[model samples]
Target: MQGPAVFIDLTLEDQAQELRKYFKSLGAEISQEKSTKGIEDDLHKIIGVCDVCFKDGDPNEIDAILNSIVSIMVSIPLDRGENIILAFCEKLTKAPDIPLARVCLQSLWRLFNNLEPSSPLRYHVYYHLVQVAKQSGQVGDVFYGVDQLKSQFAQCPPSSEQMQKLYRVLHDVLKDTNSELSSKVMIELLGTYTDANASVAREDAMKCIVTALADPNTFLLDPLLSLKPVRFLEGELIHDLLSVFVSEKLPAYMKFYKEHKEFVNSQIGLNHEQNMKKMRLLTFMQLAESNPEMTFEQLQAELQISENEVEPFIIEVLKTKLVRARLDQANRKVHISSTMHRTFGIPQWQQLRDLLGEWKTNLNTVQDGMVKVAQAQVELTRKQKAAY
Candidate 1:
């Protein structure tokens, strides 16, 4: 079994016979029930052989062996699937070779659904699934597959302790990698588990991912970065989140810097004027959106800026496309047709309520005018009828 080059050169018939012989050495029988002890020993032997086969065997030989194992599990009766699953888990747990473990993982996925809800092997399967994925440089695929299995095996919810373990393993996997794949996987997990009953482990996994994202050592402005599931975290939690990017001085924060400027200078310990510009620009836009016509004096008073600064700030906002307004220097006012609000809170909500109320009042007035016009028409028609 040391060098499988000879096996690769063999004819199809010879290779099939050799595969059967290898399984026979592991005491594999034709779909029969055996003692647990007997099965464990056989599994150990099979794993040892497969480990060598993957190392020394050619691609064709390894593929053939994997295909044969899958075929045996599939052809076996439903009752026998558990044995194969446990055997594969055993191999996965003991095998130090990731290549061999990945190969064995294929069979585990194939036979996973066959396992019952009460099967003890489910834990073992997920445990190794995470490990193999983390070490194999295919963390995304591994976690995704495990997530599917978790849904399938819905009957057996892990204990709180077990959930913690699951979360920790996933955290380690995400913490070690900073690729788009890792970020996507982390985002998916956060979206999946962000409820009140979300396990402590799930929360830990999210923290681990967000920490990695804001880490200077592994920061990337990936497309998935903006989709971080932070709705479940608010208030001080959001503030604490800002500290991660602030301390790292990540450029990724430049886009939404206005929203988190509360800590830009005070807590973040960064002496950058960009935050001031952002805050002022954002407040200016909010005021313009809330008002259709505003005098220069009002803008200055609202933004706490000088008259000279008002026009320049408005011009900058116009350049940024944050608001659509015409500055009437002669009239000393701005005519705003449309605008965008960057952040929403109590002030914005209150503005929206007031605007809605005003809209309702205007609509009522229009309707009353229409009624009055209809009454006038009716009276004129009656007079014309009398004249006829």
Candidate 2:
């Protein structure tokens, strides 16, 4: 099983068939969500059949199976239905060594090419497939499909309203370095994720994609640089992308852990890690534009606002909708909205002192006027008496 060509030795085909049967039995137990545990050991039982299939043994059979899988993957989305794609994805984990499993993936590959705005199954398949792809590190498949969907034609073409779900799915998943496809293809596809005409949704999607593409960890840096998608948007969006990317410990921070673990720890060390928490609070205040439904601890983690500082800020922000707290829980914290503007008004004590100063100045002026009036009155009285 070298390249896309899957080869089996003469002795192994029978066991492969029986193993396929066994895998189908396990299909009921498969879950679509990502798991922390490795799928390798779990898949070992299934792949072991391929081992039995090889006249040469497990290593050769496994190579053949992986090759078959890789080959079928490229073309499956063009022809398969959503149900079948799912069935195949579940089957792959249980039956990776079998031809039937490869066939399921193959059908799935073909089906992707058939997706369009008019296709009844387009969105359903797109949504499910993107998530499956993400979990399995098959982003290249979805990326290629999306690339083909974005019509660059001048004439009216299929709309990407269907793509909304796909983008949403991607937004939830952390972009893994291992899953990168052609960066050029990814950028081209992402261009359609946000239709600038849709306003809020468009803005959000654009912002997400911009952040994703600008992310230093995303595998397609050269592709992003080559396409320059971020520049096409307004500077603010690009800045946001940069800011978020940097705030996530920067792409180079991994290297820093190796080279400067002490330094990184020292930075977080001050105030016994409270400094980072305060930074998060500031971010919540400044960067979060949507509903900031944050817990007190989350607020603490995000805003680094001290317990003392939080109460005052919470009291102040309560006037706005951004802050909320439970009366019984003193740990309650404010959820900052992204749109809130900072107003650094004069200090309350300073205002009080200025008011007192003005009052004293006015009192002195009134006193001087009263004394003058009194002196005039006395002179008039004295003159009248003399005339008499």
Candidate 3:
């Protein structure tokens, strides 16, 4: 909303083209107004005056003004999705001023959520919408956005829906991998699950887990059945992304692509040689479960590779710490230790949990045995004194 509304009257068909300039200037500023107070002030002034265009004015004139604002929001993005939702929320003090924008936002959100997880929009709009919900500071709204995503994922078409959903979402997200943004948004959403949490994205993610797990046929029966669902999405998506990197068109940054190509020759069974590295990465992850202590060299040795070749490969594995290492300085061996396997290599948190629980149980058992042994010793001493 801009100009004196006098512009609305001129309607010089030729100059109508320039009318968009006013909205563009304001649209540029929209990303800067983050907080509610900031958005409210600008929105108030703009709408207060812009309302005139809508007041008893021609429908097309009204639409033109509003559409300019809408168009900017649609076209621009901080990463993906409209960059202006926070600004919208900031300035949305007047319910009447926002009805149309809110409607459009909701509709757009629904459309993105309904697409496959591998959908290009997932990396674009759906991903951004989650961030918007986080920025909105409204728990219900954040979760609502997340729910739309989870529901779409959960209701994936029968047979191959799960695979397709992951397929659609993973590529773009991997391509546009601004991991900082993804990590921040996920942290914010996860933190919001508590009463203090206002992010709607977090709440909705929780709801999806509850609903999806309840239906055994559609969703995979796995660890996601418990408190965490992200575990499933992360591992599956990563494995898929690795597959893409291993493709003939290797990503520009893959330094070891050639070696990875050679190493994967026979390790990956049916997973084509193109997908060999990916399969090995995941296969090694699978191996970690049983022999968590095994080193990359040990794994390479299992594949009958030279100790010299093993060193460079281990350097790569060392970066992720997927396998722990120890130097056999004298004999020159590296070991992984113990994997404690699962669908993927076990997450550290799970191990911490098991260790803590076992510690408590062991302490209790040790205390009980000590108490019984003390009593028996006391009685035995009493009998020995009497016999003497």
Task: Kindly report which residue stretches of model 1 are placed more than 4 angstroms away from their true locations once superposed.
Answer: 1-20, 23-41, 67-87, 90-105, 113-123, 134-136, 144-152, 176-388
What residue pairs are clashing in model 1?
none
Please give the distance, in angstroms, between residue 190's alpha carbon in candidate 1 and its true position after superposition: 9.2
After the best TM-score superposition of candidate 1, give how far the Cα of residue 380 lies from its true spot, in angstroms. 14
Candidate 2: which stretches are off by over 4 Å? 1-104, 110-119, 151-159, 170-174, 178-199, 202-214, 217-388
Per-residue CA lDDT of model 3 for 1-388, tens digit only, reads 1221112333232232343344335452222222344332343334333433433444455555644443333333324333244333333322233333343334335434343454433334443443333333332453333334456546332233332233223322421233233322333233333333233333334324322222212112133323232333344422233333322122321434354544333332222332444334445555555563555456664544566766665566565565565555365555566442334225657878899999999999999999999999999999999999
* lDDT-best of 1 and 2: 1
Error of 2 at 50 (Å): 20
Candidate 1 lands at a TM-score of 0.44
Candidate 1 lDDT, 209-326, residue by residue in tens:
4554444333222222233345333344343444333232223345445565655445444434643454465556656656899999988776667989988988887887767989
Residues 19-47, candidate 2: write the lDDT tens digits: 45544444523333322433322233343
Q: Is candidate 2 or candidate 3 better by lDDT?
A: 2
Error at 52, model 3, angstroms: 22
| lDDT of model 3 at position 175 | 18
Maximum-TM-score candidate = 1
Error of 2 at 123 (Å): 4.7
The best candidate by lDDT is 1
So what's the TM-score on candidate 2?
A: 0.28
